[model samples]
Target: MTPTQRHRVLALTPYARLLSVWQTLGIHTDHRCVRGPDTGMAMVRGRMGGSGNAFNLGEMTVTRASVVLEDGSLGHGWVAGRNKPQAELIALIDACARQQAWARRIDSELVEPLAEALEEERQQASQAAAATRVDFFTMVRGE
Candidate 1:
Protein backbone atom coordinates (compact mmCIF):
# COMPACT_ATOMS: atom_id res chain seq x y z
CA MET A 1 0.00 0.00 0.00
CA THR A 2 0.96 3.61 -0.40
CA PRO A 3 2.03 5.60 2.65
CA THR A 4 -1.33 7.35 3.02
CA GLN A 5 -3.28 4.09 2.76
CA ARG A 6 -0.90 2.39 5.20
CA HIS A 7 -1.31 5.18 7.72
CA ARG A 8 -5.09 5.00 7.43
CA VAL A 9 -5.04 1.28 8.16
CA LEU A 10 -2.72 1.72 11.08
CA ALA A 11 -4.67 4.58 12.55
CA LEU A 12 -8.11 2.99 12.16
CA THR A 13 -7.18 -0.45 13.40
CA PRO A 14 -8.65 -0.98 16.87
CA TYR A 15 -6.37 -1.02 19.89
CA ALA A 16 -7.36 -4.59 20.68
CA ARG A 17 -6.73 -5.75 17.13
CA LEU A 18 -3.33 -4.06 17.07
CA LEU A 19 -2.40 -5.53 20.41
CA SER A 20 -3.39 -8.97 19.23
CA VAL A 21 -1.17 -8.65 16.15
CA TRP A 22 1.71 -7.33 18.22
CA GLN A 23 1.50 -10.18 20.67
CA THR A 24 1.10 -12.74 17.93
CA LEU A 25 4.19 -11.48 16.18
CA GLY A 26 6.15 -11.35 19.44
CA ILE A 27 7.93 -8.20 18.32
CA HIS A 28 10.88 -7.48 20.58
CA THR A 29 12.80 -5.06 18.43
CA ASP A 30 14.96 -2.35 19.86
CA HIS A 31 13.12 0.93 19.55
CA ARG A 32 12.44 4.16 21.38
CA CYS A 33 9.71 6.79 21.36
CA VAL A 34 10.98 9.93 19.66
CA ARG A 35 8.01 12.16 20.31
CA GLY A 36 4.95 11.26 22.37
CA PRO A 37 1.56 9.64 22.53
CA ASP A 38 0.38 13.15 23.32
CA THR A 39 -3.22 14.18 23.09
CA GLY A 40 -4.19 17.43 21.38
CA MET A 41 -6.91 19.07 19.34
CA ALA A 42 -7.08 18.95 15.56
CA MET A 43 -9.33 21.13 13.45
CA VAL A 44 -11.68 19.25 11.18
CA ARG A 45 -12.61 20.87 7.88
CA GLY A 46 -15.50 20.34 5.49
CA ARG A 47 -16.74 21.58 2.12
CA MET A 48 -20.16 23.08 1.33
CA GLY A 49 -21.02 20.26 -1.00
CA GLY A 50 -18.16 17.92 -1.97
CA SER A 51 -16.00 20.62 -3.52
CA GLY A 52 -17.21 23.97 -2.29
CA ASN A 53 -15.66 26.49 0.06
CA ALA A 54 -13.94 24.89 3.01
CA PHE A 55 -15.02 25.52 6.57
CA ASN A 56 -13.89 24.38 9.96
CA LEU A 57 -16.26 21.66 11.11
CA GLY A 58 -14.88 21.49 14.61
CA GLU A 59 -11.94 20.39 16.71
CA MET A 60 -11.41 16.78 17.61
CA THR A 61 -9.16 14.97 20.06
CA VAL A 62 -6.06 13.52 18.43
CA THR A 63 -3.11 11.58 19.73
CA ARG A 64 0.23 11.38 17.97
CA ALA A 65 3.48 9.54 18.56
CA SER A 66 6.72 8.67 16.83
CA VAL A 67 9.28 5.93 17.19
CA VAL A 68 12.85 5.35 16.03
CA LEU A 69 14.11 1.85 15.52
CA GLU A 70 17.66 0.74 16.13
CA ASP A 71 18.35 0.89 12.43
CA GLY A 72 17.28 4.52 12.38
CA SER A 73 13.95 3.94 10.71
CA LEU A 74 11.51 6.63 11.83
CA GLY A 75 7.84 5.98 12.22
CA HIS A 76 4.97 8.28 13.08
CA GLY A 77 1.39 7.69 14.16
CA TRP A 78 -1.61 9.93 14.45
CA VAL A 79 -5.02 8.77 15.49
CA ALA A 80 -8.31 10.30 16.55
CA GLY A 81 -9.20 10.20 20.24
CA ARG A 82 -7.00 9.74 23.33
CA ASN A 83 -5.72 6.24 23.14
CA LYS A 84 -2.06 6.57 24.04
CA PRO A 85 -1.20 2.90 23.67
CA GLN A 86 -2.86 2.72 20.30
CA ALA A 87 -0.85 5.64 19.04
CA GLU A 88 2.37 4.13 20.32
CA LEU A 89 1.56 0.77 18.76
CA ILE A 90 0.89 2.45 15.47
CA ALA A 91 4.26 4.16 15.60
CA LEU A 92 5.95 0.90 16.38
CA ILE A 93 4.23 -0.79 13.50
CA ASP A 94 5.16 2.09 11.24
CA ALA A 95 8.81 1.72 12.13
CA CYS A 96 8.64 -2.00 11.63
CA ALA A 97 7.02 -1.48 8.26
CA ARG A 98 10.08 0.41 7.16
CA GLN A 99 12.26 -2.58 7.69
CA GLN A 100 12.44 -4.92 4.72
CA ALA A 101 12.35 -8.05 6.85
CA TRP A 102 9.12 -7.11 8.59
CA ALA A 103 7.26 -5.40 5.75
CA ARG A 104 5.49 -8.41 4.23
CA ARG A 105 4.49 -9.90 7.57
CA ILE A 106 3.07 -6.56 8.70
CA ASP A 107 1.11 -6.21 5.49
CA SER A 108 -0.35 -9.69 5.57
CA GLU A 109 -0.89 -10.11 9.30
CA LEU A 110 -1.94 -6.58 10.21
CA VAL A 111 -2.82 -4.35 7.29
CA GLU A 112 -4.83 -6.77 5.16
CA PRO A 113 -7.13 -7.99 7.92
CA LEU A 114 -7.75 -4.48 9.21
CA ALA A 115 -8.49 -3.20 5.73
CA GLU A 116 -10.95 -6.04 5.14
CA ALA A 117 -12.69 -5.41 8.44
CA LEU A 118 -12.97 -1.70 7.70
CA GLU A 119 -14.37 -2.39 4.24
CA GLU A 120 -16.95 -4.76 5.76
CA GLU A 121 -17.98 -2.06 8.19
CA ARG A 122 -18.43 0.43 5.36
CA GLN A 123 -20.49 -2.06 3.37
CA GLN A 124 -22.77 -2.80 6.30
CA ALA A 125 -23.30 0.88 7.03
CA SER A 126 -24.05 1.55 3.36
CA GLN A 127 -26.58 -1.26 3.29
CA ALA A 128 -28.26 0.07 6.43
CA ALA A 129 -28.48 3.56 4.92
CA ALA A 130 -29.77 2.20 1.61
CA ALA A 131 -32.51 0.34 3.42
CA THR A 132 -33.82 3.64 4.76
CA ARG A 133 -33.47 5.57 1.49
CA VAL A 134 -36.60 7.05 -0.08
CA ASP A 135 -37.21 7.96 -3.71
CA PHE A 136 -39.44 10.80 -4.80
CA PHE A 137 -40.98 11.37 -8.22
CA THR A 138 -43.23 14.02 -9.78
CA MET A 139 -46.40 13.25 -11.69
CA VAL A 140 -47.55 15.59 -14.49
CA ARG A 141 -51.27 16.51 -14.79
CA GLY A 142 -52.60 17.23 -18.27
CA GLU A 143 -54.86 20.30 -18.63
Candidate 2:
Protein backbone atom coordinates (compact mmCIF):
# COMPACT_ATOMS: atom_id res chain seq x y z
CA MET A 1 0.00 0.00 0.00
CA THR A 2 1.08 3.56 -0.62
CA PRO A 3 2.11 5.90 2.23
CA THR A 4 -1.20 7.72 2.09
CA GLN A 5 -3.09 4.47 2.33
CA ARG A 6 -0.93 3.40 5.25
CA HIS A 7 -1.57 6.68 7.04
CA ARG A 8 -5.28 6.42 6.49
CA VAL A 9 -5.29 2.92 7.89
CA LEU A 10 -3.19 4.03 10.86
CA ALA A 11 -5.59 6.84 11.64
CA LEU A 12 -8.42 4.45 12.42
CA THR A 13 -6.75 2.52 15.23
CA PRO A 14 -8.08 4.65 18.09
CA TYR A 15 -11.68 4.27 17.06
CA ALA A 16 -11.36 0.51 17.12
CA ARG A 17 -9.77 0.74 20.55
CA LEU A 18 -12.52 3.00 21.87
CA LEU A 19 -15.20 0.66 20.57
CA SER A 20 -13.49 -2.38 22.06
CA VAL A 21 -13.14 -0.78 25.50
CA TRP A 22 -16.67 0.56 25.45
CA GLN A 23 -17.99 -2.88 24.61
CA THR A 24 -15.82 -4.65 27.22
CA LEU A 25 -17.01 -2.44 30.11
CA GLY A 26 -20.69 -2.68 29.12
CA ILE A 27 -21.11 1.09 29.40
CA HIS A 28 -24.53 2.05 28.04
CA THR A 29 -23.50 5.25 26.29
CA ASP A 30 -25.22 6.23 23.04
CA HIS A 31 -22.01 5.21 21.26
CA ARG A 32 -22.96 1.56 21.46
CA CYS A 33 -26.75 1.87 21.14
CA VAL A 34 -27.39 3.71 17.87
CA ARG A 35 -26.60 2.60 14.32
CA GLY A 36 -26.81 3.67 10.62
CA PRO A 37 -27.42 7.09 9.05
CA ASP A 38 -30.03 8.00 11.66
CA THR A 39 -27.51 7.11 14.33
CA GLY A 40 -26.55 10.74 14.61
CA MET A 41 -30.03 11.62 15.77
CA ALA A 42 -32.14 9.44 18.03
CA MET A 43 -35.03 10.09 20.37
CA VAL A 44 -33.68 8.33 23.42
CA ARG A 45 -36.29 7.51 26.03
CA GLY A 46 -35.32 6.66 29.55
CA ARG A 47 -35.95 7.61 33.16
CA MET A 48 -34.14 10.70 34.39
CA GLY A 49 -32.87 9.10 37.55
CA GLY A 50 -34.41 5.63 37.63
CA SER A 51 -37.33 6.91 39.73
CA GLY A 52 -39.60 9.10 37.64
CA ASN A 53 -41.60 7.83 34.67
CA ALA A 54 -39.87 7.34 31.36
CA PHE A 55 -39.49 10.42 29.19
CA ASN A 56 -38.14 11.30 25.79
CA LEU A 57 -34.76 13.04 25.83
CA GLY A 58 -35.49 14.65 22.49
CA GLU A 59 -33.24 14.48 19.43
CA MET A 60 -29.57 14.58 20.30
CA THR A 61 -26.91 15.14 17.65
CA VAL A 62 -24.44 12.32 17.34
CA THR A 63 -21.49 11.29 15.16
CA ARG A 64 -21.50 8.61 12.50
CA ALA A 65 -18.86 7.91 9.90
CA SER A 66 -18.33 5.33 7.17
CA VAL A 67 -15.52 4.51 4.81
CA VAL A 68 -15.69 2.89 1.40
CA LEU A 69 -12.70 0.85 0.40
CA GLU A 70 -11.06 0.74 -3.03
CA ASP A 71 -12.82 -2.55 -3.71
CA GLY A 72 -16.23 -0.99 -2.97
CA SER A 73 -16.55 -2.51 0.48
CA LEU A 74 -17.79 -0.43 3.42
CA GLY A 75 -17.21 -0.37 7.16
CA HIS A 76 -19.21 1.82 9.50
CA GLY A 77 -18.69 3.25 12.98
CA TRP A 78 -20.72 5.53 15.24
CA VAL A 79 -20.76 7.13 18.67
CA ALA A 80 -23.30 9.27 20.56
CA GLY A 81 -20.96 12.11 21.43
CA ARG A 82 -19.32 14.52 18.98
CA ASN A 83 -16.04 12.79 19.48
CA LYS A 84 -13.97 13.09 16.30
CA PRO A 85 -12.13 9.87 17.00
CA GLN A 86 -15.37 7.91 16.95
CA ALA A 87 -16.32 9.20 13.51
CA GLU A 88 -12.84 8.66 12.16
CA LEU A 89 -12.84 5.11 13.46
CA ILE A 90 -16.06 4.34 11.69
CA ALA A 91 -14.58 5.57 8.46
CA LEU A 92 -11.31 3.68 8.89
CA ILE A 93 -12.96 0.45 9.90
CA ASP A 94 -15.09 0.75 6.81
CA ALA A 95 -12.01 1.20 4.70
CA CYS A 96 -10.29 -1.71 6.39
CA ALA A 97 -13.27 -3.94 5.96
CA ARG A 98 -13.28 -3.19 2.29
CA GLN A 99 -9.52 -3.50 1.82
CA GLN A 100 -8.38 -6.45 3.87
CA ALA A 101 -4.76 -5.75 2.98
CA TRP A 102 -4.73 -2.67 5.20
CA ALA A 103 -5.99 -4.53 8.22
CA ARG A 104 -2.62 -5.59 9.61
CA ARG A 105 -1.18 -2.09 9.43
CA ILE A 106 -4.20 -0.65 11.17
CA ASP A 107 -4.34 -3.27 13.86
CA SER A 108 -0.67 -3.05 14.84
CA GLU A 109 0.13 0.66 14.59
CA LEU A 110 -3.18 2.31 15.22
CA VAL A 111 -5.36 -0.03 17.27
CA GLU A 112 -2.67 -1.23 19.66
CA PRO A 113 -1.48 2.23 20.65
CA LEU A 114 -5.02 3.50 21.07
CA ALA A 115 -5.86 0.64 23.38
CA GLU A 116 -2.66 1.11 25.38
CA ALA A 117 -3.29 4.81 25.83
CA LEU A 118 -6.83 4.21 27.00
CA GLU A 119 -5.69 1.52 29.45
CA GLU A 120 -3.04 3.85 30.85
CA GLU A 121 -5.52 6.64 31.31
CA ARG A 122 -7.94 4.33 33.07
CA GLN A 123 -5.23 3.11 35.42
CA GLN A 124 -4.24 6.66 36.31
CA ALA A 125 -7.83 7.62 37.07
CA SER A 126 -8.32 4.56 39.22
CA GLN A 127 -5.14 5.27 41.17
CA ALA A 128 -6.12 8.88 41.72
CA ALA A 129 -9.50 7.84 43.09
CA ALA A 130 -7.94 5.21 45.32
CA ALA A 131 -5.54 7.72 46.81
CA THR A 132 -8.42 9.82 48.17
CA ARG A 133 -10.24 6.90 49.79
CA VAL A 134 -11.38 7.59 53.38
CA ASP A 135 -12.18 5.29 56.25
CA PHE A 136 -15.01 5.79 58.73
CA PHE A 137 -15.51 4.39 62.23
CA THR A 138 -18.21 4.57 64.92
CA MET A 139 -17.73 4.60 68.68
CA VAL A 140 -20.04 2.70 71.10
CA ARG A 141 -21.86 4.79 73.72
CA GLY A 142 -21.84 3.65 77.37
CA GLU A 143 -25.21 3.55 79.14
Per-candidate TM equals 0.87, 0.53
Best by lDDT: 1
Assess each prediction's global lDDT (C-alpha) against the native: 0.88, 0.56
Which candidate gets the maximum TM-score versus the true structure?
1
Q: For candidate 1, write residues 3-51 as lDDT tens digits.
A: 5678898887788987887788766898889999799999999999979
- TM value for model 1: 0.87
In candidate 1, stretches whose alpha carbon ends up further than 4 angstroms from where it belongs are 135-143
Off by over 4 Å in 2: 1-39, 44-59, 83-89, 137-143
Q: What is the per-residue lDDT of model 2 for residues 28-47, given as tens digits with 9 covering 90 to 100?
A: 21223123343457678889
Please list the Cα RMSD from the true structure of every candidate, rounded to 1 decimal place.
Answer: 2.8, 11.0
Q: After superposition, how far is residue 19 of candidate 1 from its true place, in Å?
A: 1.4
| Candidate 1 pairs with clashing backbones | none
